[model samples]
Target: MAETSRGIGGLAFDASKRARPPELNVLIALIAIVAAFELLGRLLIGDSFLFNTRDNVDGIFNQQRLEIIILQVSIVGIIAIGVTQVIISGGIDLSSGSVVGATAMISMSFAQVALVNGQPNPKGVFLEQGWVDLPVIVPVLVGLACGLVAGLINGALVAYTKIPPFIATLGMMVTARGVARWWSKGQPISFPTESFAAIGKGLMPVVIFVTLAVLFMVILRYTRYGKYCYAIGSNEQAARISGINVEHHKILVYSIAGVLAAVAALVLSSKNLTAQAGMGVMYELDAIAMAVIGGTSLSGGRGSIVGTMLGALIFGVIISGFTFLRIDAYYQEMIKGVIIVAAVVLDVYRQRVRSRG
Candidate 1:
């Protein structure tokens, strides 16, 4: 009888330990933020805020505002997904924003259609008579190819040339922005095929965001590649000694990041029906913030796609909340920065506590 009781107690203890959820603390913080914002919008701002409609409890469920928030963050969220992989592999990417700009310009150039019936091509801002009517696939392929090449360059510089990840990506960032401007002489490239525009129209960005998020979640959770990412991020030298092809994997990871950035550019251009050389300015910062806010460690090795998705949601909600409260746009930016810093500090403190415990 005593043996049976002991066994039951042991089982209970084991279950309790296992039941302790990871990142519960972060989740709590997120909930607090939402609740605080909701209250502020309802009481302080009244109807002046973007999200303070009296008809619907701040109208978080308002289809139009929800759609707008999703659209606004979808491109940055895509880049954040890639950045998650890079950080998990013990690296960083500062070039993704610039990649978006460059890819948009270059790809839209291929999508231009010739003017017809004196109506001019509405898809393009500069309707070049010679370059219009190209197949839809051409621009997409070109954008992806550009992304692949840029990613490869970034990977090579870091992996083969022994450059620091930050330096390599920084160089790429500048180069890509220059390429974006040079492609169209600093002018917005407008006019894309109707079919091409459909890629970023309406709910398509949300669709792509959801699909990619699911795919990456599976990849990071179940595959050997995922295992290696955690292993490398936790300890690169140890990972290499264990027979992981650290260099090749790094190259592949950054390249994948580039491809994802291109996907973002495609969606952005399609939705806007015009590609600007400055289309993705400052987007990389937002992506990084999303990843970090989701509780992904900057030190690498520990993160999840689920966390990233949640982080994106948090970001969207915060932006929406600010607008709902009628906060000035500039003030919103300042508050976001503060929140990011607070999150990071909290994360570091948590890590320390876990280690001590």
Candidate 2:
């Protein structure tokens, strides 16, 4: 009996000292993914995944491909950062994609230039000329307000009415999409003023995403708001009893998420120079997938902006690598689905192991 107790005590001691930061594991996975693509590129495409063997470029790396990878994912990466926070706070948001679509349409209308080549702008949404060529802030504030209202409604429903987050967000998703289509009668909104266009030019989206990520990383790690989020997510009853305003925090979290979605809309619309009702389709799913793959637990109380950023990179790398290998788009979708499920399964397994220990 004494030996048995000693053995158990030793195991516990070992387990206590074995604690590892989850981000390290995610970083390792990212490196492994990059290496895999490198190997496959050489074998299947006779080209490199990240390196440039061509003599035209002085650098050893494929700079253009690298830029494309970052640019392509930067917009969605913004949404992922918000999704990471929401998940950590034990809530789900299914309306961010729709919010992007709606905000884009509405904002673009106010951003229209008065004339195109010295003629009345053909794509103007407003019949009155006064609505055209307005200040860029007009559209920006209007767009953000749309997101804020939608988020407030979502938060109120989830926090006060006790509606399930999935149902609440799903309802907002449909409503926001309807609003998007209605905003322009299913027509695309195009042509913004020069000031508005600058918002997403070149690498601006990447800069915006990285800036937000770093800012939020600090917020989540150091602020009382961050502590409340983790606490509420880990155990709402316990947090409430401990004096954390769970309901209020929930509202704030959803509100922030909504604003982030709007930010993404602004960047996306500016980048494309147009806003279609179909814009941002399936973006919410992709954002959630990025967060999950970055090691965020869907069960809540655990996630990070940094992890989501890395996940976005992983997502971009995989897609770019597949295209470089000339893989079918259908196959690419299937593989992406597999990766999402695998990540979720791994998270569940980790949770179970932790519980058992």
Candidate 3:
């Protein structure tokens, strides 16, 4: 009986030592940042800032400001979700931002409604009324299809041609931006069908973002594909040797990323009732920053969607906080750059420590 009790105690000790809790450190940092911003808003800028008015504690709970933050971040958050997956698979995608722009422009062309019943709408960019009054599904499908093709090309270049992810995605980035500009000749496309506009109306982006997030969380937690992402990210050669079809998986991951970017594009264009060729400029960097800030390692093999979500929230809060503080827009950009660098440095430090342990 003594021996058995000793063995049990030893086993329990070993288990405790081996188990590492989920990285709550990022969450703590995020909370601290928010609190700090809130305090600063209250003490420094007072009521002059955008979201930082000090009528009372109740006024601090501004629904409009909260909704604006969520709305602003929702589309970027969706793209960040996809970017997180790619980063976890030890890859980077610079083209996603341009992809959003290109997809938005092209899909809007298909989603345009006719202003004149008989004659072509002079205000419309596309002369031919091919799919006028088509179901909302048409534009959505068009956007997804564009994304699928782009993702396939990106994946092929990286996985089969042995192109570096950076170079391949950079090339795609330029190409996608050029496509967006050339498609509409630098003109903004407008007049989407009411149904199409409805897709992004109200809190729809938030709803879609939340729903997709939940679905992806389940998939990443329970699916074989998610397991393989970690395996490849941790060690690609080993994953290949394990017969995991690394190439196919890479394609799938990139495709999913593309699809998500396309969805973001659709929502953005629909909400604005117009699609500009430059709509998604710099969004890729923001998405990557969100992933990195959320504790996703750029070195790969370790991350969580929850972390990405929190990171998005942190980003929204910071931006809103800055506006609340009545800071100059240029200063906000500077602050964002500094924050991103800090996040990357912290990620590297954590990686080194984990490796040593």
Query: What's the lDDT for candidate 2?
Result: 0.90
**Pairs with backbone N, CA or C atoms under 3 Å apart (clashes), candidate 3:** none
lDDT of each: 0.84, 0.90, 0.86
Better of 1 and 2 by lDDT: 2
Q: Which model, 2 or 3, shows the larger lDDT?
A: 2
* Model 1 CA deviation exceeding 4 Å by range: 1-23, 47-60, 116-129
Error of 1 at 11 (Å): 17
Model 2, residue 2: displacement in angstroms? 18
Checking candidate 1 for backbone clashes, the offending pairs are 51-324, 113-132, 113-133, 114-132, 123-191, 123-192, 124-190, 124-191, 125-190, 125-191
lDDT (10s digit) by residue, model 3, range 260-302 = 9999999999999999999899999999998999888898898
By lDDT, the better pick of 1 and 3 is: 3
- 253-337: candidate 2 lDDT, tens digit per residue: 9998899999999999988899999989899999999999998989899888888988999899988888898999899899999
Question: Model 2 misses residue 51 by how many Å?
Answer: 1.2
- Residue 339, candidate 2: Cα error in Å is 0.7
Global fold similarity of model 2 (TM-score)? 0.95
Task: Give the top-scoring candidate (TM-score).
Answer: 2
- Ranking, lDDT, top scorer first: 2, 3, 1
TM-score of each: 0.88, 0.95, 0.91
Give the per-residue lDDT digits (tens) of candidate 1, residues 1-357.
646545464643334433244356557766787778767866785543234454646545456766776677888999999999998888899999999999999999888767645677655544544667788998999999998988999888878887888999999999999999998788887767788988998889989988998999999889999999999999999999999999999898999899999999999999998899998998888898888888788889988877877788778878887887777899989988997898679779867976775
RMSD of each: 4.0, 2.9, 3.3
